[model samples]
Target: MRKNFLHFLIFIFVFCFSSFSKSETCGGADGLVCCNTITSTSGSVCAIPANNKYIFTLRRFGFENSAGEVTWVGTETSFNAALSSVGASMGNFISGQSLPEGTYVAVRPEVKLEMTVNGSGVSTSDSVACTSGGDQTENLATVMNNLSDPIPNCSSSPNEDCNTGDGYMRIRDTQLGNFTVTAATARTINFEFDVGSGVLFTASGGNCAFRSMGPLDVTMSFSN
Candidate 1:
């Protein structure tokens, strides 16, 4: 009788542990989606330029709860930096902050549409190498201003599909589904930026001109 009771207690503990572990899902509409490549039409391609430097400002960062309400973690401050420089530094954005204990499903980041892209890519139109004169800030406010979606739409079927002339821009939001905040512990989010297919090149006046800021591969991770 004592052995049977011990076995029953062990079974109950295992079942409860499994149930609690399964409740925390890390991906979906409520979590992060990392894409390394852009979906493009035929004859249109994306590549990392020789010197690709993407600079933008992060305006706001926060998390969304299951109730569709957002819980902001920090003040509205301009964090201007190059895309390559935002890896481990992302943790600083939420430093010294605590979230209300709840299950969060999404990450919200308000970014300024004005960005600078400096790189050189082989033009799909004529296979010519095109490069930006320097770091020229392009205002993408017309297409991506105040856009909630972080994933950009770069599926336009054209020779310059990834170029601004064709009105192609890549933006997509990162989801963090069902992330529960317990005890308001210190948390950090890590980011990996893959610029392999981040720029599209086109021939302009016998020189390479930036057509548009192509899809940027961004992978995000969270830890306590």
Candidate 2:
């Protein structure tokens, strides 16, 4: 009986030690999922993305609409871009999710923007083209063109926040494909998920951006 009891105790110790070792591996710097805060803008993280699993669901593109605006963020869903060849690179991460470094075909979507404030406004547009063009506009544009809602009380930067006036915005549906992640000592690809029409925004020639809500904790990474 004493021998049996000793055997059991040894087994327990081995099991406990094994579990601790596994936790230490997963919680290390080269781990999969992380608790680090995903910032409002594109940045780096400690984990690789593809090593994780999904709590999958339909990620339909929709707007937060007025007071629901706080929910717009970049980390909830993943975006895919089809490249013509392996040499393609997405310039400046191409405005969304962390993609493997190399040359990417298209980064920013081609769209027009017209943001008007109390009186002043800005207008810009761009042609849609890739290594091949197939009209990616319907893929992710979240716009509220109706002038029905009462505009909010203005109190912010006119360029970044348009509290009143007619507004229009759209996101090109990202083409889905299997992408190659160039090997690195460490790298990250992130997408700007927070989107909107007339809140805090940035207007260039063909791209319009509002302040992002935030990013989720999952990442998609690949290796050599």
The backbone clash count of each candidate, in order, is 18, 24
Alpha carbon lDDT at 139, candidate 1: 62
Candidate 2: where is the Cα deviation over 4 Å?
Answer: 1-89, 92-143, 147-187, 192-224
**lDDT by residue for model 1 over 22-82, one digit each (tens)?**
1111111212221212222222333444244666555556567788677665454443223
lDDT (Cα atoms) of all candidates against the true structure? 0.41, 0.21
Candidate 2 has a TM-score of 0.16
Deviation from native of the Cα of residue 140 in model 1, angstroms: 2.9
Q: Which regions of candidate 1 fall more than 4 Å away from where they truly are? A: 1-45, 50-52, 76-84, 121-128, 141-174, 184-188, 203-207, 222-224
| Predicted candidate 2 versus true structure: per-residue lDDT over 9-120, tens digit per residue | 0121110101000111211233322212222132222221111111111222222222223122122232221111101222211223233233332222212232111101
> How high is each candidate's TM-score?
0.55, 0.16
Instruction: Give the deviation of candidate 2 from the true structure as CA RMSD.
Output: 23.9
Native-vs-model 2 lDDT? 0.21
Q: Alpha-carbon error at 160 in model 2, in Å?
A: 8.5
